[model samples]
Target: MCVEKTPWEQVIDFHGHTCPEIALGYRVAQIAMRELGIKPTPSAELKVTAQTHSCALDAFQVLNHATYGRGALIVEEQGQHNYMFEYTGTTVRVFITINPEILDHLVIPKDLSSRREVQNATLEAIQFLLSSEESMFCSIQKE
Candidate 1:
């Protein structure tokens, strides 16, 4: 019985591992979809502009079908967790900026190099990202 993977599982597999940034990307992608009231399709695709190059972008690639090869994803690397999403053939655009304070709380234990400890910390951070309220983690602007 071959079963298909969930969207989240696909994202993790593509990203090579589970991490907080991927979780953040997942949440941001969901918010973008909700705010814009649309999903990316072959004809109506999404153009995503990412402020930082991180694991989170993988989520957009999986969920929004926005890929760099197709010119649907752009990364400017501004060192912040900001994302702008626009659907093709539409005037609506959504901007999401992640709150720094929320990121501050997700600090990984740098002193502990133990693989188990690091994995645990990353899992905890991913959990926090997944559970946080949209308003608490990011500010959304529509244009």
Candidate 2:
């Protein structure tokens, strides 16, 4: 019997693995594109400039079907997980952040880079982030 893969599962497959950045990217991209009123594209309707070069960038492309090859995804490394979305030159900055304090609060281990438990951590973090009233974890700044 074959089971279906979730969107995040598909993202992990295309992305080679899963991590906190990837989870953060999935949420950030979803919110950013929704905020900008941009839909999934086979071509360039939305251009994403990322502040960091990580698996996070791949999530945007995988989830929204945006990519640099088609001129849809443009990555500008700033050594951070900040993202800027542009459509017709109108830009919105969406940054994914987790309060360092929250780590202890959530009890997420420091060495969560292991693929075995990383995916669990990713999902747990994502769930808490979206479900919690706390909005400090993710920020959407308009510029």
Which portions of model 2 show Cα errors greater than 4 Å? 1-5, 38-44, 89-134
Q: What is the C-alpha lDDT of each candidate?
A: 0.87, 0.66
Task: Provide the clash count, candidate 2.
Answer: 2
| Candidate 2 structure, TM-score to reference | 0.66
Error of 1 at 5 (Å): 1.3
lDDT of 2 by residue, 4-118 (tens): 9988788889888655556667777777767777444434366677766776778888876778688778777766666777664444444445454443333457687687686
Q: Model 2, residue 6: what's the lDDT?
A: 86
Each candidate's TM vs. the true structure?
0.91, 0.66
